[model samples]
Target: MGVVTSIIHKKINEEENTILFFGRILEYKGIDYLIKAEPLISEKIPNIKIIIAGSGDFSKYESMINHKNHFEIINEYIPDEKVSELFQKSSVVVLPYIEASQTGIIPIAYAFKKPVVATDVGSLSEVIVDGVTGFIVPPRDSKLLADSLLNILLNKNLKNSMGSAAYEFMKENMSWKGIAQKTIGEYQKLLGNFEKPRYLIGSLQ
Candidate 1:
């Protein structure tokens, strides 16, 4: 399916040194591991804030996180307008999924040019380019996850560069326009519209 291409990019909130986890809070989502990593990450980047924006039973791991003070848990459904706000405010977006088939968060983060720190599981590896658009760590490894997030948050230049690359990747490969063209190509092939396919390829060139 083609990604929704109607988003308008917002300027990054440069003043806030924030990391975000914006989605459902579930066991498979691995928010517990992310929370565990917060303290380790905070040790290196003391002032960095972690925003866990979603609705779920956060009390399950509330006592386990070492650096609870550094986190802001918005334990409710995030509204449409607020989605952009959260993405814009954060320096990095994290997906610490223990298991997943696919995720819509990466493309959404790409729209804001926000670099991601996701676990390597299922299709997440296909979406994230390690050391390029973002970093992918092994699932449930809080230390490695923290290190990857720290690497992005501590270095502003790297964050900005990766974010820019993320956006470019979205525009080039995942944009609805590109997806529509591919769909059209398939349809044309089925219909034996050879001349139109040539025209399409030529125009792209």
Candidate 2:
């Protein structure tokens, strides 16, 4: 599902240490936290490239970006074609949302075999197994967010391990078949009927 490396990310120049914070830009998405974490991350890995892509007015965030030279901001709609390339070039995907109902970004990152660093918001915690698929930090905590991102960026084995786990998690849990199976299991447990229903059977579809 990966596209050949493209100019969008090659322009970052340092793909290995790159962290992606992509998706629609909005106040509740906590771009500020990622910005605050930059200096903290730079203190350890100096040449890190942080790519912030998606549509919205980014001018409001100008004041927060202290490491301006290290950041590549795409403050307009990104085409569907280029998304996979962006994910492929990134070492980790970060979700620093202060508030969120849910997000589809984590699965996309996993599909690229990329690990995620997300804040505890909405259903993100349910999908991202902390320290396994990715690390889950507290919302709006820049230091912890920085720490989690640094963990994946600095450790190659851990990053790959987590990314692989994330991909498997997505594959096994996100599939309709898996969902239906789990649903059937839950019904059996709820009704205390572990035995297969022979007399009265029903189809899930």
Candidate 3:
């Protein structure tokens, strides 16, 4: 997953207490957990604003979003070009996934140099370096998730530092060029001992 490298690192409408969930709305995506965690988060961080930006049937999650004043849902498809805008404006990106392989959102948030709060499921724990780049809480635990978000949102210095670290991690490890090179290296190692098929070469010639 590659980010728009052209989008320079500069603060764009950065709100210190804004948390975002940017992706498709689905049950497994754990938007419900995030919504459930909101009351707990708001109890601690009163000024917190949660922006749920994605396209889906948000009506299913209506009951969980008890704190409507603190939660704003843009229940429509976010255009590819406009994705960066949401990433840039928020203080932190949240992926409270109950089950996940990986998500493009994590790297995109890293590209924007925003800290993340994600659930400890699938590759999320591996991607987010807890207390370094972002926080990873136990899956389906709204309380723990809220605690993690509150921790980051409450501390400005920690939030900024984590965001910076996230950007560095993305540049060093998650860039598409690096991933491609690694894939190529693995292929080369695997194929180095194989003899070229003479018939295929002759056909090409």
Candidate 4:
């Protein structure tokens, strides 16, 4: 993994300020708004690298980019073997989705101990504890998205704090043991009597 990671580092030109826009580049993923936020993000970070890694038709989005030099686009299906290397290389993960049902990206980012900056849509926000795990901005609002990215990129301490929290959140909340405990707690709290929830599981309404 280290050898491959080194190769990826070269591909990224060793840019640590890189924000990754990963996953399938579909319309609902809102790559357009990311292009719109390019200038705003560059005004502050300057040498920022926005790495778009995933399989999709990118010609349409290629023309929309302003600072063409600042982007590192890999418009192809990233293999599972390389996925860890890619995430480990990123400073932050971004999901500028305009529409979503749910996403598994948040947990994946957290697992890598990387902070995420995603837009509020569907169940995305429900996962991110804004300003704690990561920042959640309004969907389709490029400025807010850019601002959140800037916030994470500019402050190293804040970024580290958020990343650590993100990992912990996933470790504790998304795990089977944690989920079971939380679920039982919720049931107990709802009943206010520590009663068994056997009857509540559609056995008796």
Model 1: pairs clashing at backbone N, Cα or C within 3 Å: none
Root-mean-square deviation per candidate: 6.4, 5.5, 4.8, 5.9
Q: Which regions in candidate 1 have their CA more than 4 angstroms from the true location?
A: 1-12, 184-205
Measured with C-alpha atoms, the lDDT of residue 168 in candidate 2 is 86
Task: Please give, for residues 30-139, the per-residue lDDT of candidate 3 as tens digits.
Answer: 98888888888888889889999999898888876667899878899887656767788799999999999988888889988899999888888888999999998999
Kindly list the per-residue Cα lDDT of model 2 for residues 1-205, writing each as its tens digit.
2222232342332278999999988999999989999999999998999999999878899998887988999888888666867887889999999998888788788777789999898989999999999999999899999999998888999999998998888777865666788999899888885565665556532
**Quality of model 2 by C-alpha lDDT:** 0.85
TM-score of 1: 0.84
Poorest 10 consecutive residues by lDDT, candidate 4 = 1-10
Worst 10 residues of 2 by lDDT: 1-10
Where does candidate 3 stray beyond 4 Å?
A: 1-3, 6-11, 184-205
| Tens digits of per-residue lDDT for model 4, 86-144 | 78789999999999989877777887778999988999988999999999999999999
Per-candidate Cα lDDT values, in order, are 0.85, 0.85, 0.86, 0.85
Better of 3 and 4 by TM-score: 3
- Give one digit per residue, the lDDT tens place, for model 1 in 1-205: 1433333335445445798999988889998898888888878878978899998888887887676679888999887667877888888999999999999899989888889999999999998889999999999999999999988888889999999999988887678886788898899888885456665887888
Model 4 ranges with Cα > 4 A deviation? 1-15, 186-205
Better of 2 and 4 by TM-score: 2
